[model samples]
Every structure is written in structure tokens, then in C-alpha cells.
Target: MNTLLLHCRPGFEGEVCAELSELAANLGVAGYAKGKAGGAHAEFVCSETGGAERLMQGARFNQLIFPRQWARGDYLALPETDRISVLLQALADYPQCGSLWLEVFDTNEGKELSNFCKKFEAPLRKALEKAGRLVEDPSKPRLLLTFKSGREVFLGIAETSNSALWPMGIPRLKFPREAPSRSTLKLEEAWHTFIPREQWDTRLSEDMTGVDLGAAPGGWTYQLVRRGMLVTAIDNGPMAQSLMDTGLVTHLMVDGFTWKPKQPVDWMVCDIVEKPARTAAMVEEWISGGHCREAVVNLKLPMKQRYAEVRKLLQRLDEAFKAERLRVSIACKQLYHDREEVTCHLRRL
Candidate 1:
């Protein structure tokens, strides 16, 4: 009854478990995390009564790196004959929810259950309303029912403010047909994830200037151009002629690692395929050395211990900035559009 369920990208379940186990232990909530590799989900079972509450109270969702989303509640194994009754009974003692989201894992089997979830939603809502367990108040918590299979489900709850904006932590972003490459979506997703939408007008204005490293085919550069920023795109390879036609980009054939802007720019972006540590160090230089006021860089991860590598890199950045007495804010996430890498956003405060 004291389990915390976490949803993550498939194949990173071990990393998620490692992260949550460490986090829970650090917060003095004795627990253990369990999940098979590639399960796409994990669970942390607390050792004592109300441990889940304490764990949730101490942990900040945004600070967690491995898990895409999480919820804390009691687990319920439903009867085959009347599954709806089992759900209602399990929720009897819980508070009313402003909304309900029926979720499944991010696996092939989970996708197969999508139709079931959609069909079950209406009846579930009707039952909740009839039983006084559902409300329309945004201030209330949202009920999250995560189904692992037709007969197994985890009944959990999360505050809307503390959870992901969309179900399953997936944002509904579309690829622009005009963009030169599919990689453009990665940068677009990074913006939506890292920068608050309301602050975009001021922080990402068209009047700013930017530098895009490894800008071949002009994927990341296109995003900057679309935002109306003047871009200096550096790469040894060719860029899309259509992007060049915009008259907003200056292409320079040079090494991304060695190339530097003559003066400080508004933003510095890189999507080069290289060791993640190297990319992280480059980003640190750009931010701490005052080359750019802000940056969004991608770190190509190793196959093993990806989360550990990310933590180490972030720690390295923090220590480097602290030693220089620089005021900076940093955030990182494994974006949905990203594979074998994670995106980071750094801004000088």
C-alpha cells in the first residue's frame, strides 16, 4: 500500500530505479526500488506506514532526472469479474480527484491497451462522479491509474502542479514540414521542456543573436532562425540551401570544438556527435566564459550507466561554475525526441 510508481523511457528502468532508490534513501525514507530492465516503469516500496507520503513530501519532481513522471499510492490487484468495482472500492478512502488519467507503460503492450483505456475512461468517470470521488476543481489532486495489464493496475495520485503537463510525460509537438531535418524537433522539444512558455517572449526574442555548432543540414539552426534570431552556423559540412536563402544565417566552415564567437552571443547551441563529457565541458566553457548568456546542448550518452554519467557531468558543471563565482541556472532532461542522448539548458542569472 506504500508504493511509489514511476514512468520512464523503456530500457532505462534500471537507471530510474537506481535514481529513486538513492533519492529515497537520502531523504530518510527507507525503501527499495524494483523494475526489470526494459520494463518502462519502476516502483519504490516504502518500509513503514505513511512512508510514501514522507517520500513524496521531500522529493521535488522536477529535480528527478531519470523518471519522466511519478505517483504515490496503494497498489490494487483487481478481480477479473468486476474490475470497476475493485477500482471504486480501492478509491473509497481516497480524496476526490479533479481529474483522472488512465495510463499504461511506454511499451508495445502498453500501446495495445490504448483502446481499452479510452473505452474505460467514460465509465470510470461516471462511476467516480456518482460515488463522489470526482470533482471539477483544479486545486484538487489528479487520480492516476496506471495499468500494467488487463488485471493489474496501480492506483496512484499526484498534484497537477507537481506532475507532467501531459499524460505519460509526452508533449504533443509536431514537426514542421519546412524545417530542414527531423532533428529540429529535438531543439523545439528542449525549448518547451526547459523554458517556461510565458518567458519565451523575453528570453527567446527575435532580436537576439545565436551560434549553432555542428550546424550541418541546419536542423538546430533552423529553430533559431524560426525564432527570428540572427544565427552564425559553424560546421565543416554543407547546410540546407533553403535555410541559407532566409538571409538570417551566416555559415562558417570550422571545427565546432575550436570555433568561438568573436563576442558574447544571446544563445549557443550544439548537437554534435561526440563524447558526452566533451560536450558538457564545451557547454561549461560557453556559459562560464561568457560566450553566451544561455545554451541548449545535447550530450550523447554511453550505453551503460547513462544516468550516472549525466549526474557526473552536471556535478562537474556545478563545481566549475561555483569555483568561478558565476551565477548560473542549469536543467537537464532526456527528451522524448532524443535517443542515446540528453538535452541540457543553462542560463546565466
Candidate 2:
């Protein structure tokens, strides 16, 4: 493989290219990146043969931000009539894939191919299985076919363990009707992306207490209440009566930035609209001050230099944690529900 296909937010193609170029350089792999504005995807082409494979083997997908999913392969143009046969032949040398995900980009044009992809999947799966190019084993690499057009596709390999669980890394979540606001999906998605399902009950146990900064309308606090946790909702605006009626929350009318709990809580969730630097500083202060054991905060990225800004903000937190001698695990992701902000999860170990 000499090219890496990367998926990112629709307008963040430049960020993906910048991230990949930096990552490839660090891995000592010479590669060039390119993508169109608002394409929702990017590609990295290696200057040397095998460099793509080398970079893929060396880079950790979760560590890199911006790109939700990545695959390694060159594009193929197939005749529309016999595309299945063309695909099977292309996989002659590939290892048996554990699974197959026929995907499209997140753009409008990409969505148009969804129906065709759905129709093509069953026959293709049967054909691959019959040919022994696919198996039920989850330990193997996954076969990824991203269709750009009826006659054009990107046939690639996605490492099962190193890749996102969802196709295109977009987790399909049904917005809860009970949620006070649609913004609640950000926290829900963050948990799904950063924490393991099996550990949810333990980490988010019953009776655990949490605080919601800027919690007006109680959208995020609704999440904590539903989980059987007591919450202190901080905001100047009135909260939803449904959440207040739950009897699991304490609504405090105050500025989230200036408030502090009497004692540390189990968790602190923030969604204040502010500059990325300010948001980062808020999260860092809460973490370093032992205000909460864990936190989920949103950083509204600047219009320019977003990736570079994120790196600096994260580094600031890293340095502060080191100076405080705290063992903290921090992870951040741009959730599908998130607009221009990225969610960050911080847990003290």
C-alpha cells in the first residue's frame, strides 16, 4: 500500500492533511497529503514504496486527532456491470478480512451512494465468503470499500484493533427524547468514544455525584440524573423542570467560570461556549486543582490554526499535570454531534 485514506469532519480536510504530514514525518516516512475543501476525507501518498504500510504500522490511530478513520490502499476503477468480480480479483493477495464495511463520505454526494452500497453489500459479502477472502474472525484486518462513484472505489485494509469501530468513525446514536437539549449527545458520544462499554457501570456507578458547569437547561445534567447520580447544575439561566423534578439535581444560578463546589465531586462536565484557550484553561484548572476525579469538557476551536491550537492546549495541560505530579489520562475527539468544538475526557489515575 502506498496511500492512506483518512476521514475527517467535512470542512477539516486541511487539518487532516496537516496532521498526516506531521505524523508521517515523525515516523520517518516521506509522504505528501492532499484533499479538497469540505470533502470530508484526505489521502497521504508515500514518496517511497512501502512507506504507507510503514507509517500505518507505526502510528496509533487513537493518538492522532482530526481523522476519525483511516485505510491503506490505492483507488480502483471498476466496470459497473461486473464490479463484484473485479473486487474479488483485487483481494486475491489480501489476508482474509474479519469484516467488510461498505462506506461513503459524509457529504451530500456521498450520502447519495448509501442506497447503492446497501444493495451491493449482501451479494458482495456472499461472494467474498465463498472465495475465502473474508471470515468471522474478529482478529483479522477489516476490508474497507469506500465508494466514490459507481465505477470508482477505494479498496483498502483497516486494521481491526487500530481502527474505529463504526464505519467512517461516525457512531450512530439516537438522540434521547428525554434529553433537555440535543447538546446532550456530545457527552453521550464522548463516553462511547473514550470509555469501554464494560466499564461504564463501574466508572459511572449509581449514586455517583457530578457537577455540570454552564448547565443551563440541564441538558448534560439530564445525563447524570438518568444514570442515578446526584448533580449540581451551575448556570444563570433556568433549567428544565423535568430534570429538576427528577430530585437528583441541585440547580445553582451562577456563572460556571467563577463557581466552585465545597468539596470535589466524582465528575465535572462543562460545555461553556468560549475560546479554545479559555476552555482548555478551565479544564486544566479543574484537573490540577483536584476539583473532580474526572471531567468531560468541550473546547470551541478557533476558525484558524485549529489543529495547532489544540496541540498547544493539550501540551499545556500535560506540562501542568507533570508539574503537579498527577497521573491523568486525557483523550479528546471531535464527535459527530459536535459542531466546531471537540470533547475532551480527563480521568485521574
Taken over the whole model, the C-alpha lDDT of each candidate is: 0.89, 0.89
Lowest summed lDDT window (length 10), candidate 2 = 332-341
Model 2, position 87: C-alpha lDDT score? 91
Top candidate on TM-score is: 2
Q: Residue 239's C-alpha lDDT in candidate 2?
A: 93
lDDT score for residue 179 of model 1: 88
Task: Name the runs in model 1 displaced over 4 angstroms.
Answer: none
What are the per-residue Cα lDDT tens digits for candidate 1 across 245-316? 999999999999988898899999999999999999999999988999999999999989888889999999
lDDT of 2 by residue, 95-148 (tens): 789999998888998999999999999999999999999999888999999998
TM, every model: 0.96, 0.98
Clashing pairs in 2: none
